[model samples]
Target: MLRGRARREQAAHAGGTPPADDPLDAAQERRVRAVLALGGVPQADLPDGVQQVRLRLLERAAKGEEAPRDVSAWSAVVASRLALDWHRAKRRQERLGERLAALRQPEHQPSGEDNRLLSLAVARGLDGLPDNQRQVLVLRFYADLPVRSIAEELGVPEGTVKSRLHTAVRALRARLHEDEVV
Candidate 1:
């Protein structure tokens, strides 16, 4: 009886099965389910490669081949990496879908009085300014860029950005003030 029991114990450990009385079996199953759910890997959608990796990890745990202290840490790392990969793949699919939708839609054309008025105002303002001032104002306000970003985009220094912004603001304020008076 002692020999038979020993053989069974050895077999269980070698085959990666929990012993008949192992308390961790139920806890391990629950942990695996939670990890899979949190990683967004539904049983039906689990890829073969991922499933294989998870199974190998679980088998090692079941056989008491992996350290008890490291199991949770390893499991968490795997779950986090899987979740990150899923999110990246989902984002790519969303971007592709958006591109396809844009391709299917007709190009937008401005046709309203408001659009025309805005265009005319912009054109008149741009025409009135010197080229450098116009470029600065367009980069600063029209593009809604910060001074640092504008400087970087224009390959100029931050001081130049500040000066350009100050000059443009004064010019626009003067132009608007004159238009109001007229």
Candidate 2:
């Protein structure tokens, strides 16, 4: 596959028109062949469609419609984005499958070490804090809210929010260090 791709690249660099017999450049043709040969794809699968899209992209590239001088870089970015989309779709499908499987199975309780030590420590530190300090920490970390948002939510000034967050963080750090020692 690599050799075929190399040959195609060489042909492309040679500046000859793509052969009438082979619609794709040598590398693209090899990629199509490799994808078809993979058992994962049925003969009628979208590998051919993907190849066609890639070829079109390449053709556009060759015609200088796209950044031809940085074709490889652009192609890499396109391929990476495509792969990321595929993975995200796959993950969504897997989550749906897991939900269906859970519906069919008996309810299962979680059984593991109570990993809430950090939570407990933080809670203890928070309990010892003034209400404003606790609110700042809860908004910033627990709710994942931004400082400006927290300030708006609490109807306070942004500087006040920053000050509270700073104090909360310092207190938490000291508490966490003491917890580690004990």
Candidate 3:
């Protein structure tokens, strides 16, 4: 129908997917949008709700079912249903995000004694590393020096600094595993 085509063109111009050859006429589309907006659907999602209603109407036609006796009323109901579904989905996402945030929080806060013991173990581990390895490790970790800066400060190539850092961390990890300090 000319009216359907015109509505599709208008939808296209408004940055929505044009419901090409849709069953809903212009007035019907307007009613669908109004119903969706009034049902608490956000403005940005109104076009999508309208498209859903149009798709359902076309789907009925595609299935060889008789068109609804009252197209406007049917579209309005469909739009309202879509709006409710959207709200339900939004609430579900908010609940899921809250659950994830709760999971990320620490269940038991570390005690001061635990932190002190860990710090002592780490200091002892550092003391056991070779001089060059220990120097680079301290500069990189404690002093928060980058690889390039470490190389420049120590007058060593960047690759050499990286190799030392890797070997040192491996050795320290092995030592910690052997001591059961971690």
Candidate 4:
């Protein structure tokens, strides 16, 4: 059995320190909300927007983007950018869908016949990439951060970031072509 309150997370909004089941600190949530609001995201959509930021960061981390040292600040950056991306995606719904769908199939293959092959091929290629190259690609594409932002977050020069991205893309392209997915 477990013992001690140290193992449990403390809830901040509560009147006193109590164990909180929510993984995100109440303070961090506030930062995320503030960022979303500042980005012109609706107050009504704040929760969903914050959730989007959380999920995106987690997804990027899983895909190989390094977790930030300052999670609260990182979440703010992510929330603001995600809000922008959400608006952009909403503005281009039809065009984005067709383009995204096109990635899974060739000109004649049906869209639903398993677009996963290409995704799997890409995953395999990512696995083969060097750590630095892989991290840059995940940070740029999955986290949707710009080169400068990625450089700041990763503590590297922007030129280094570009080089890693270039190498990563070349490797993935070669892998995909070899696999005949491209």
Best by TM-score: 3
| lDDT (CA) per prediction | 0.65, 0.63, 0.85, 0.78
Better of 1 and 4 by lDDT: 4
Q: After superposition, how far is residue 42 of candidate 3 from its true place, in Å?
A: 0.6
Residue 146 of model 4 has an lDDT of 80
What's model 1's lDDT at 4? 98
Q: Put the candidates in lDDT order, highest first.
A: 3, 4, 1, 2
- Measured on C-alpha atoms, candidate 4 has an lDDT of 0.78
Candidate 3 lDDT by residue in tens digits, 69-124: 99999999999899898888788667667765664466786677866776788888
Query: Candidate 1, overall lDDT?
Result: 0.65
Winner on TM-score (2 vs 4): 4
lDDT of 1 by residue, 1-182 (tens): 98999899879855766567543453553464566567777676543324544576768768878554755556556655776666766776676677656644656644576456655665676788887778888876545457898788889999987887788777766775665521
Ranking, TM-score, top scorer first: 3, 4, 2, 1
Give the range of the ten consecutive residues with the poorest summed lDDT in model 2: 33-42
lDDT of 4 by residue, 8-67 (tens): 433232443324544356688888889888887878999788678668666877799787
Comparing 2 and 4 by lDDT, which wins? 4
Which candidate do you rate higher for lDDT, 1 or 2?
1
TM-score of each: 0.34, 0.37, 0.51, 0.49
Off by over 4 Å in 1: 1-119
RMSD of 3: 18.5
